[model samples]
Target: MSRSTYVQRTIRNTIVSEKSFKETLDSFLYELRFFHPVHADKMIEQAMEAKDPKVFDTLAEEASGRFGYLSFGDHKVHRYLNKFNPNRPVLESHAIALGTSPRAYSMTKHNQEATINFPLRITVTQRPNDDRASVTWDLPSSQIPNLHLNKTLANAAFFVDDKFEELIRFCSGTMDEKKYKKILSMDKGAKVGAWKDAGGPTLSKL
Candidate 1:
């Protein structure tokens, strides 16, 4: 069963206190850096350093990216995307897909074509009403092509959701970052399971 390359979730917060809001944004940047992304910093710096008027939205947008953050209107968005299709997003309504490479995630033993950088976007919206806010997990693209071939992309997205449940901890006020589960252990375990049936030519000599 083929799955759409898109996934999105919106979590509404009833009590978006000023302090909690600030902490959320700070934690967001912290989480992005925690993975040691390769391309986000330069893009963030250029956005910070742009002196002249950034007139057009396009010129305003690339100030470079794929694994970077940007702000517009009520939303603050950051994405690590590859193979972007500019026709307009089919799932998430946010349009922050500035084109470039996708090398945000760390390399894994399972996705060793060096091609498994997850194509994801995080959109935090402070709604028109100051009291309401939402965090949307927008998966506008996936790291794997099985998105349209089978339901693997959807399955992978589900796995990611499970690993990162603590992301919304600001809503509850106790974000024990240390308790967050290891994100790629499932992938490693899946690889090991496949190894049990290792074929004729690829068995390890060791």
Candidate 2:
């Protein structure tokens, strides 16, 4: 694509994204009390502090043609509705910080053990005309007991971006299974405490 064309597309996307974000934000804030009181402050901070709210085309579900909220931010929890953040380096650093990549939760390895400590939610909707995927990360929940927002973003980014990138690469018939399995088996660190022990991936960086 030409530079002019790319710029035009970007400008158009921004216009659409900003409008959708405002619509979603008002709805999210209105229902904040049901989710948690903490989000009231967080939502306001998110709206004002981040001048350009991040855009995540991945989590932005579409209907007919235009993207809009279907239910509960339309599969986007809070900031992630259209927020494309936790870029590549931040995703990697946060994964290391949390010590838990999304790969850590292998059902076969655990013999189907069910737990909710580190949740990496994944929803795949096959697109007949698309081959690419988008990625982003958000805090686990504003109400989780001890883990703060930054730590949660780090942990979630693994699943959202880093690990999903690998999954996409592998499924695209580019990567060999042997290499992918090796990547999966390696332990990075424990998710909850790695933040306490050795923390450096800052929120600004994320």
Find the candidate with the highest lDDT and give its number. 1
- Cα miss at 100, model 2 (Å)? 8.6
* Candidate 1, position 119, lDDT: 35
Per-residue accuracy of model 1 over 154-202 as CA lDDT, tens digit each: 4433333332333344322443434322322233212111112211223
lDDT of 2 at 153: 37
| Model 2 steric clash pairs | 54-83, 54-84, 55-84, 56-82, 56-84
Query: What is each predicted model's overall lDDT from 0 to 1?
Result: 0.33, 0.27
Residue 171's C-alpha lDDT in candidate 1?
Answer: 27
lDDT of 2 at 83: 54
Per-residue alpha-carbon lDDT of candidate 2 for residues 57-176, written as tens digits (9 for 90 to 100): 211211101101112222433235225553521111001011121133332123232233233332222222333222222333221333233454334333233332333333332345
For model 1, the local distance difference test gives: 0.33
List TM-scores for all candidates, in order. 0.33, 0.20
lDDT of 2: 0.27
